[model samples]
Target: MILSGMATPTRRSVLALGLLGCALPGQAEEPIRILTEEYPPFNYTDKGKITGLGTEVVQAVLKEINLDAPFQSLPWARAYETAQSTENVLLYSLNRSKEREKLFKWVGQITPTDFYLFSLKSRNLHINSLEDAKSQNLQIGTVNQDIGEQFLASQGFAVGRNLQSSAKYELNYEKLKLGRVDLWVMNELGAYYMSRQAGDDPAVVLQKALRIPELSGGGNHMAFGLKTSDAVVERFRKGLETIKKNGVYDALQRKWL
Candidate 1:
């Protein structure tokens, strides 16, 4: 009874139509762009590939959802801006702060770190607390836009006056070595790593400096752009939970720490 201009549907056509109807709706059409800065033991470029604890954890989470996203290492400020402006963007090893609480959709905590004020042993600097350091009126070296810098700024340390901000952590280390800055503010682990990278024995450097604990911002986290869909964020959150339950998260931490 089909018209000459109309094609007749067969059993095969009916089955094909049924299969198309079963396809999942609202599937993500694009891969997420993960961003990070060169913070060693967390996320950094090694042998032209992004590899680190945070990177590994993120990869595992994405794998659970059958998604693979490549990490792009950019300057901290640039990465922060890009994640703020772009949808489907992810950033990790990000410190959770009151000022940054509502800026992004947080996924889960990654790792814990302690910030400290390090001064050369030669200076014999004695600082038991933040108030003691402030009394000294020392020039503190910090990476631009880093959490340490933010914390100091919140404490009334002004840039170009008592705070010397550098775009690279290595530059801050250099400033510390040159005595351009009296105290270098950095993460405990990061200070050791940067000391090693600067061709100094990390243990020796640690022995030579005083590590006065300054800021302990609970922990770092993986976060997505605020505009990203809740569904996508949930997928990542579930994946993170799955990995943690399966002991993969602890394994990654052991490997790095």
Candidate 2:
């Protein structure tokens, strides 16, 4: 089911009073620091601005909860680490994996998505199974701490061996073409979106060599650092539910995907 992840305040005006009503009566509410990276149409930098479907949804959720958070984009690895190390932080479009279940407080899901091992169309690589890809000993480009990286690691793809990790998503895209990495794993939508961002047609530049079902279920979410109060997490969760019920969620999905 569609759920949560977050936004930039410059583009989104905070609502004076959300469903949480925390904006009223001179109450002091702790501000949340929302973080994400370049993984579109989930979230990405667009014309020097952080935006995408996830950004919009999180912005809407902030409005519902009477909360204001600054949306910041960092390299995937740094953002992941910051969210883990800092308190009162919200990270999104996060893949809700079993490996990460206890690391953070999950607010809710954002949207359903598929992950794939992608190869340049020109290479004509064939990977029918994870083992097939592993047997090839081909270098796979990935973003550090991304779900794609973590899943491949679980499958025995080790860094500096078969996995070549970069801090930025677009770097992996470049590595695929430069022949530095034989393949890259990313969300299906991001494959197309990133290709377009680089001014190439995904149909012409890339092909899905294998689909990783392990990365499919509960792929995107908004999660707070473990130290974040349960009360805050519940507030955001309720806010996400509010948007979904009010038809705001569907409108955003249609706009971005």
Candidate 3:
């Protein structure tokens, strides 16, 4: 409050006092939080360290931006929630779906992935469409809040009925092999990558039962939360563009993909 005899400060006076530059006494910018999940080749934990295709691409982008934010691997659901609601938070390898287009400020694409519903060749699941899979009373495995899970939910699939959600993809992978889950919805590259990680020959064991066109193509992206400034978002966007233009992106693809 102003004093009894004090006059209201004019715009020029406020600027002169440097009040415009610092809106509040201690309102400093929040620390940057870069988060990802264990989706593999894109981003995953490896032998007590975090590194992958998407992780490395993001690092290159950060280098171009001259920003020093480390990546943290979290559960998919938690990472999604935190990236949506928190300020100065960046998440990568995110599917730039129409349902999520306006949720955050997009940076740029990482790498392309073909999404599919995979099942064991032993089961010989004859799934050709979403309806076909649902009609058969097949249990579909998914990671909670993952893009595949969310897409199915939007199409009226609900939990405990036909959709089975897990915190990790490994659980779903194991379940699918054990006949616990009739189908596993995942990207083709990730499905094979994960199968190899589990010491199985994906080509021999897993079959791509159905292709999801909407969820495929156009690759994934690095995105900032809504609370972030457009200026910061643009800076990071330019960084991604820089890496893609300078041959760094191609190098990463060859290294990890």
User: lDDT tens digits, residues 113-144, model 2?
Assistant: 88899999998999889888889798999888
For model 1, state the Cα shift of residue 25 in Å.
12
- Best prediction by TM-score: 3
Higher-scoring candidate on TM-score, 1 or 3: 3
lDDT of 3 at 255: 83
lDDT of 3 at 12: 56
What TM-score does prediction 2 earn? Answer: 0.87
Q: What is the lDDT of residue 44 in candidate 3?
A: 85
The estimated TM-scores of all candidates read 0.84, 0.87, 0.88
Pairs of colliding residues, candidate 3: none
**Each model's lDDT:** 0.81, 0.86, 0.86
Candidate 3 local distance difference test against the native:
0.86
Candidate 3 stretches with Cα past 4 Å from truth are 1-30
Model 3: residue 31 alpha-carbon error in angstroms: 2.3
- Candidate 2 collision pairs: 3-109, 3-110, 4-109
